[model samples]
Target: MTVLALEPQPLAFRVRPQADECFDSWIDRVAAAHETTRPALFRHLGLEAAIASLDLARGTCGLSNEQYFAVYQVIGQLAWAVEIEVQQIEGTFLNVEASVVLPRRQRRYVCPLCWQQALRDGRAPIIRKEWILRMSWRCQVHALPLCALPVADGAMSEQAVGSWLSGAVARAESLRWKLGAHPRLVEWNAEGVDTLVRASRKRFKGEKKAYVDRFQANLFHFAHDRIAMLALAHSRVGKATWGFERLVALELPGRPGREVMTLQPPKLPPRRWRISKGSLRPGSHDAGVLDLVLAYAHLRVRRDA
Candidate 1:
């Protein structure tokens, strides 16, 4: 099947009243970009959870809504990487540079139900408006949101990038704190630490300590294990295959944006392995690293099968 053929209906909507309310506005913009059926519910659940957590966090840090949203924007921008699928058609794939299809005017482009109906009918949905005209300067396909958009000269500095990265890392760390540490996380480490921490914190408000503790521990182990598996798996892509046991013993970094070369916990038993370059998966590691891990895991599974 063509890449487009396999693509699901995207959730789409424009953020309403783009002026003051940063968090609400982001929810709108993200929802617009998302275009799936029941877009509001998805937007609400994800955005609301993030907002609620921010409120709690602010109790300790004294964050303003704007500040919280600013951090949220950073998280939104860096937390998911995007992958562009360029497929060869009758000949080779086009080598054209991709650009933002800016929107001509502020308007609602797609009704969620209508788009779903079209997808259900097996018709390929065309983004009818010119891409750049339809999108905001804030929107970028392959790069992270908010920060990835083009800026005036020297507008986005290395220091700014560093700040964004640091914030992202801190958020991930918070999530990890809630979940508790695990060998699995150590195994395929990515930036999901913050997400895990949040999950754990959200648990057990009304449950028994024994059950809550057990569940939280289980979640920690699961989260850590899956992330670790992904890290170890990614490390082998384009590289030689090692036995599954060998994979477990492998040490990889557990943060997003961390290069594979930087994950030096210690040496493992000597075993043949392959190293692949330029095969990172976008949006996998809350930035890009975890995506590599997932891609590697897929390759391993195929080889083993």
Candidate 2:
């Protein structure tokens, strides 16, 4: 007997996001570009099954693998006129977050300079991946505090958010204090540190690695074993990996960034120096501090080449 084959399904929306963009922002822009609402798009993508389990409009992990492809196919067919590669648009950014749920940021953040540039280029504002990580707060590129996007009640149209975007950029630019922008953030990412840590952890053989999730192994050594911290921090041509064992031996300190790198702002816009000094308290040593450490960690990752 001959068997009948089923046809692959298509998604409702036809648009895709630009590079380094987040799924949340991509969906909203797609809705706006298509002159439709997200709820309407959701209904079209057969995403109802995953909707209750996720905040489909605001989250990156909203849809399952199955649903993601259904939506991807639809958007691909619609946006075929554009030059984007579908794989890079979705499910392509690798991270540890997929297996673990991370707490949400208390406030929204956007880069004013980035928004201005994206608009100039005729592209939607790209939502960066690092901003979703709790460890990120400042925009390294503009050396500015990421301004907040006021949260609206559910289903606010994309047009409303677009208007809010312009206001948020103006507000972020007028801010009293912000960090000096890193000149080469185009080449920086936290994932590079993740790769380094993964390589370093191989030295442990059978040791527990949960702490590696935060690059805590190096910090653990820096805090509890100053001697090893001293050694590892003084990276050499080929001996850094040898110090990994000694590094993880120690308990952590109250502040690891201070131990790793006494990070300082690069260059402040004139008249904002006073505010920048107060806003960035080195002693508080929070995620912003972690950002420095992670960036420094990536610098080391590049040395492998």
Name the best candidate (by TM-score). Answer: 2
Error of 2 at 164 (Å): 5.8
* Tens-place lDDT digits, model 1, residues 57-100: 11123456676565544334322312111110101111111221
Q: Clash number for model 1?
A: 42
Give per-residue lDDT, candidate 1, residue 272. Answer: 55
Give the least accurate 10-residue stretch of model 1, judged by summed lDDT: 86-95
- lDDT string for model 2 (226-260, tens) is 22222223222112233343345436587664534
How much is the lDDT of residue 141 in candidate 2? 74
Candidate 1 local Cα displacement, residue 175, angstroms:
27
Per-candidate alpha-carbon RMSD to the true structure: 21.4, 13.5
Q: How high is the lDDT of residue 97 in model 2? A: 39
lDDT of each: 0.31, 0.44
Q: What overall lDDT, based on C-alpha atoms, would model 1 receive against the true structure?
A: 0.31
